[model samples]
Target chain A: MISSIGRFIIGVFSSTGGVVILFLRTLYWVFIGPFQKKPVKLESVFYQMGFTGLRSVLIVFFVAIFTGIVLAMQTAYQLEKMGAVLYVASLVAISLCRELSPVLTALVVAGRVGSAISAELGTMKVTEQIEALEIMAINPVRFLVVPRFLALFFMLPCLTILGNLSGILGGFLVGVGSLNINPYLYLQTSFKYLELKDIYTGLTKSFVFAILIALVACFEGLNTTKGAEGVGRATTRTVVISFILIILADCVLTSIFYFSNM
Target chain B: MQRDYSQEAIISVRGVSKEFDGRKIIDNVSFDIYCGETFVIMGCSGSGKSTLLRLMTGAIKPTEGSIIIKGKDISKLRTYQLDELRKSFGMLFQYSALLDSLTVEDNVALPLREHTKLDEEIIKIIVKMKLSLVGLRGFEKYYPSQISGGMRKRVGLARAIALDPDIVFYDEPTSGLDPVVGGVIDKLIKDLSEKLLITSIVVTHDMQSVFRIADRVAMVHKGKLIQVGTPQEIKNSENPYIKQFINGLPQGPIDFFKEDIGILEEFI
Candidate 1:
């Protein structure tokens, strides 16, 4: 038992080290590689943007809008007794923007984009494609991982913004459609308590979440061994680890935002 | 089977050994490969020839000793230096390893696009030329999955020669193909060696290929060099292991079931 626990601890440390090295390598390629005659291709970055951001709009909308509706209904249930049901709009809008939208959108993207990247890279690793790239003098980290890293870093924040808007719309539907609240009053209440900092804080969390998803996914993919089984395992681990890190980061950021009054 | 010593050796493997998890996969093995020669390394599946190929490619570092390509010790080079050296050679994987997402033309043009400042139209012409050299003309629009296995291998050959490198290493070039297609690939390897003056190192267990392409052949068994000679010399070799391997005999000094020790442990 002790030996197994020791092994687990060592595994964690080594993998953490691996991820840090990958992160540093990606940063170097993005910022410094261009000056050294190794520019990152804009075409590759745009292709990745289409995959991560454009293709993901519908799923994010569905998830965020539904969460918004459920949230509005639940808050109104208790607020109805207090005769303050109008606060439901403000509550859903604030919570979704400050926490739910960023975390939820990241989780969805982590499931969709993160798993695909890991599985793709894992298959390449096993099949000698990555090795082929290496033999051709192409740095796999620069060629394969950099565009993906930059795409997630920028696009996740945009996705979170979309999620924030859809969620507010969902809450508005619940507030004005069935709850008999005036549409104008619902809009007023929603923005009355909401601040610019709330949306930006969520966007900030998304940027952090983007780093986590890209690093963990690419790290897992690049290190895949064995064969198809290894690729499947890497994909699963990417999703699980990204979800954990997203929630963990959200919790920490929330506390900091709360305590600092920013 | 005597070889002319006039040509200097381009690749020299010196007492290289590779170990994995405390187990030696490639024992101390040394050999010299001359410039513009097709040297075949043949061994059974678990015999570590693939590991040696990877070591020479600088994909993995050796546990001990050195691999020198054109007198520069590959083991000692920095990452960028190694990459610089890597651009001087190309490798063809058993599975072809073409990027599945790219069309055949894009795959062939990848090396040029990444490493050259050539115009797109110039690259397109070069891609067409390389594809035609491998007898794969007009198949440029197809992805790897859209082609036959034999065609994929030919496209892989086109990709390998895309950079016009001094050395080309092939892993199991004809492992899964009809005998006729295999002959075509074998012919390509020979033509590339003689016509392009390219040094070719092929790793395979296919006896037919060994005899067909190699100017000098090396047989490895259990991670150790058993014999190195011309096809005729290897055909006439008295070494029991080589004789057994070449003949595909069931009875010999080479025990077939000894490899099952690890598999048996897995079950128990």
Candidate 2:
């Protein structure tokens, strides 16, 4: 049992190391490889942006809007006891910007886009398409991973912003139409309570989540073994690991922001 | 068109051995493949023939010795250097390894677009010419999944020759095809080697393909080079493993199931 535990620990460390190396290589290709005469294909990056970002909008909107409505109703239930039910607008706005929308959008993208990336690359790895790329002297990392990394790096923040607006809109509808709060007052309360720091802090968290999702997905993908079974395993592992890492990273970033009074 | 002994060796494998988890997949194997000739490495499954092909392709490094391709020691070349060297070589995988996301024309045009600065028109023309050479005309817009297995293999051949590589490596080029398609591929391989005068290194277990396409044949059994000779010479070889492998005899010195027979006896 002790030896098996030890083996597990070693495996985790080794794979973590692999992920770090892959992340750095991707960063190099994205930032430095272009100047070295091998530019990342712009069309491919745009294609990935469409797949990972545009296609994910509807799911993010639904998740964020529902969460927003739930938050407003729950907060109104509490604040109504103190005759401060109008604070529901402020509560929903602050919470969505500072925490909910970014995290929820990330989880959604991690499920949709992250799993797809792993499955696609894992299939390619097992099928020798990756090896074929390498034999052709096209670095698979540059050809496959960099555009994905760039897409998530830029698009996840945009999705989080979209989610933020959608969620705020949901809260507005609940506050003005159902809760009998004045529409103008609800808007004012939301704006008054939502700080620039809150919005930026949330966006920052999303950027970090984007990195985590892209790296975890691509790392698991390129390291996939066996065959069809391995592809399935890698896909599952990408989703699981991305979810864990996004949450863990959110915790660390939130604690830092709270301590620094951001 | 025959085996050219006068030409210099273009690819040299010297005392190469590959190990995985302390298990030798390829023993100290050494051979040289002459320029512009068809050399086939024939072996049963799991005999390290595919691994040998990968080693030559620089996909994996050998644990010992070196692979020298076209006068450059491939094992010592850096990534940039390796990429530069690889531009001159093309490989056809067992499954063709065409990018599923790309169309047939794009697959053939990939190496050209990546490695050359040709215009779109020029690249399209080149793609058309290469596809025609492989007899895969009018399939340019189809994805890999939409094509038949034989057609996919031909497209793969078209893609492999897109860059007009000096040498082409084929890993089990005729493994899963019907005999007619296999024969067609064999003819294509022979024709490409002769017409293009490109060195062709093929790894396969099919005896028919070996006799049909190989100017020289190397027999590998259990990670070792059993014999390397002309097709006629290999057919007439007296080596037990080679004879057993070629004759498909169950009872020979080349038995692979010796390690687990007691388990079968126990079950029986």
TM-scores of the models, in the order given: 0.97, 0.98
Docking class of 1: high
Expressed as tens digits, the lDDT of each residue in B83-180 for candidate 2 is 99999998898999999999999999999999899999999999999999989889999999999999999999998889988999999999999999
The whole-model lDDT of each prediction reads 0.94, 0.94
A1-262 per-residue lDDT for model 2 (tens digits)? 9999999999999989999999899989988998998999999999999999999999999999999888898998899999998899889988999999999999999999999999999999999999999999999999999999999999999999999999989998889888999999999989998889999999999999999999999999999999999999999999999999999999999999999999
Instruction: Identify the leading candidate in terms of DockQ.
Output: 2
C-alpha lDDT (0 to 100) for residue B217 of candidate 2 = 94
Best by lDDT: 1
lDDT of 1 by residue, A1-262 (tens): 9999999999999999999999999999999999999999899999999999999999999999999999999999999999999999999999999999999999999999999999999999998899999999999999999999999999999999999999999999999998999999999999999999998999999999999999999999999998999999999999999999999998999999999998
Q: How does model 1 score on DockQ? A: 0.83
- The residue pairs that clash in candidate 1, if any, are none
Off by over 4 Å in 2: B258-268
**Which candidate leads the pack in TM-score?**
2
